[model samples]
Target: MIWQGRSRRKPTGGLYRPHRKKRKYEMGRPQTETLIGERKIKLERVRGGNYKVKLVRDKYANVYVPSEGKVVRVEIKRVVENPAHVHYARRNVITKGAIIETEIGLARVTNRPSQEGLINAVLIEQK
Candidate 1:
């Protein structure tokens, strides 16, 4: 389990004794790594009785073409660039701001696939 609580050490390099135990409200969850593959989705529960849609794996993306002013669904050919991590592109991990190759052309992902359930990208190059 991840703790989102206060630090154990002070800024002056002094140890801070815990006054109380951990609480459920100060908790964190693991990260979801969305990958390129067959369509797969997972629903997760969040704080305040809410639900979040997570895209576990996917092969297609909704690409918005500025020239046409419309969105099109196209097959994701591969991950080209990922600013989050260099290895993410090589492993085909889809993330926001990632440049991906699509059937229509190259696109830059605009939405968070892990949190949005679907990939949305803006067209950067036309084929």
Candidate 2:
């Protein structure tokens, strides 16, 4: 688990003792890598007594084309670019703000595919 709290050191270089142990509220989960493949989802129990569906693998995306002024469900052809990381672009890991090539055209992802279980993209320039 990742630590979600601040360090015990002060900005002036003074050490501060812990007042309490690490709580579950200060824990974080690892990042999910949404890959290109058949749809796969994982149910995760989040805080506040709720559940979140994480997409492990997804093959489709809902692409919104401004030229047509409509949203279309299209199959993702491949990852075009990922400004988040060069490795992600090479490995075809779909994250938010990634540019993906769909059946309709090139689109920029607007949502976190791994956490949202669905890919939403807005059409950019055509290839």
The best candidate in terms of TM-score: 2
Residue 107's lDDT within candidate 1 is: 96
In candidate 2, position 72 carries an lDDT of 92
RMSD of each: 2.5, 2.1
Query: Candidate 2 has what TM-score?
Result: 0.91
List pairs with backbone clashes in candidate 2. none
Q: Write the per-residue lDDT of candidate 1 for residues 1-127, one digit (tens) a residue.
A: 4557778899999999999987887776777899998999999988898999999999999999998899999999899999998899999999899999999889999999999899999999644
Lowest lDDT sum, 10 consecutive residues, model 2, at 1-10
Candidate 1 residue pairs in backbone clash = none
**CA shift of 21, model 2, Å:** 1.2
- Residue ranges of candidate 2 with Cα displaced over 4 Å: 1-3
> Which digits, one per residue and each the tens of the lDDT, describe model 2 over residues 1-127?
4556778799999998989997888777888999999999999999998988899998999998887799999999899899988899889999999999888778999998778789999999645
Candidate 1 error regions (>4 Å): 1-3
Q: How far is candidate 1 from the true structure (C-alpha RMSD, Å)?
A: 2.5
